[model samples]
Target: MKAAAETMPTLRAKHVTPHAFRHATAVHLISAGVDVTVIRSWLGHVSLDTTNHYARANLETKRKALEKVTAPTTPGGQPSWKRNASVLAWLDTL
Candidate 1:
């Protein structure tokens, strides 16, 4: 990082930390479909729960997962869940 900063004065290394790099790497790997257990092992995390936190941080992944289970549209051209307040409320609990 320092070497790049020296050659490219525009490179800002001051704001970057090892933790930031680790977080970025975790997010990237999660987005790329790597298994959480592998990431946990690579990061030396003792628990899968800790690595899951990184997985949860990827909004794109969350969105993709949501898209997979999305309710199908009804004959009215809207998902039935959209008309059910209780269903919406239940979904919010997730």
Candidate 2:
């Protein structure tokens, strides 16, 4: 810690720890579109719920998901399923 502080003065006053580094790494991985299950395995967490703690989506992530939901399924405004009567009937059964 002393040697690192000598070269980088900014870190000298900050209280950084191994756990802080681990948390930051997790958040970065999540932001990079890595799967949460993969992150859980890498972090050695036993539960997916624990990993979900680090998977909270930021505004950008939420916006991307919303865009996917609102985006057209086909180049035309109509959905592909609407063109297929059997598929539409199957969906209606649900």
Candidate 3:
């Protein structure tokens, strides 16, 4: 099995290890917007925290995601506290 894997041209990256492949898979899942819970199961991780470490999203990635979801503010726009206030009110009901 080892010989077959080694002979594959596609698997011929220099100094690649099993751990590197695992990390790559985790990162790809994150980039593809797969949930961490799904990744935990896929990677056989016993804890969600372990999956989180492996597929940790950097600050810039999160910022970009938020940017995509939120409307751009015009110059001198009023700060909108209503959104958070409504969320907090809803949480309080729960």
Candidate 4:
């Protein structure tokens, strides 16, 4: 084991720790669009807020997502669901 460690000295380089691996895994899951709740369960976190902190994205990613949202409208300036009143009323009953 000593010889192997010597061959890969950087593997035990300064400031590299197990927690870094865990943090990287969490960030990878978040980048892949995995749900926060699932990441919390995977990391055995008792509080969802802790998981949220781990998955906090940068401002640029948030801005890009917001830019992709298109408004709901039809070609003739009408609402997208003009004939969906009955469907909406049925959903409200639930």
Candidate 5:
């Protein structure tokens, strides 16, 4: 720890641990589309619930999910939200 800190002042032995590295590995595997079950086993977690906490949504995942959505259309030229008077009133209140 002393030798590593001497070369790089920013490097702290206490800041990095095996569990932190495990978290990095889990995030990387998740970003690469690895299954939750697979990750659970790789991390040797006893329960699927423990593995689920790591499955957080980031900006990239949200953008990809949005890309799959089909825009809603009403019979008229305007969208359903615009056509509904109640919705328009609610928006005005906001």
Candidate 6:
């Protein structure tokens, strides 16, 4: 298999493995916004619990998620953190 892989430029003879391909497929599907339950079924996972590991957000994904969110503000239209700063600081000390 290694020799055959070497003849094919795209195949990394030393690095290719079934698990790597499966993992890559999972990550690709996740980035494409495929549902976790569907991904689990596609990967032949017996339970959604097993698929949760692949569904975890990496730092880049988390950053993108945070970017999409609006910061919390009080009814007065001021950012909550601005009003709470002193109280939060006191709580932190405790």
Q: Which is the leading candidate under lDDT?
A: 2
Candidate 4 residue-wise lDDT, 1-94, digit = tens: 3564688887555465678889989987887789999999999999999999877786655886889999876776766465578877887899
Error of 6 at 23 (Å): 0.4
C-alpha RMSD by candidate, in order: 7.2, 6.3, 9.5, 9.4, 5.1, 4.7
Task: Estimate, for each residue in 26-63, the C-alpha lDDT of model 2 and write its tens digit.
Answer: 98899889999999999999999999999998887788
Per-prediction TM-score, please?
0.56, 0.59, 0.55, 0.54, 0.60, 0.64
lDDT of each: 0.87, 0.90, 0.79, 0.80, 0.86, 0.83
The runs of at least 3 residues in candidate 1 whose Cα sits more than 4 Å from the true structure, single-residue gaps closed, are 2-14, 66-94
**6-83, model 6: which lDDT tens digit per residue?**
788667636777898899889878877899999999999998899988988877778878899997656878767657
Q: Between candidates 3 and 6, which one is better according to lDDT?
A: 6
lDDT of 3 by residue, 1-94 (tens): 3565578856555567789889988888787889999999999999899999966776766886888896868555645554567877887899
lDDT score at residue 45, model 5, on the 0-100 scale: 96
- In candidate 4 the C-alpha lDDT for residue 81 amounts to 60
Model 6 worst lDDT run, 10 consecutive residues: 8-17
* lDDT of model number 2: 0.90
Clashes found in each candidate (C-alpha, N, C closer than 3 A): 0, 0, 0, 0, 0, 0
Better of 1 and 5 by lDDT: 1
Predict model 6's lDDT versus the native: 0.83
Q: Deviation in angstroms for 91 in model 3? A: 28
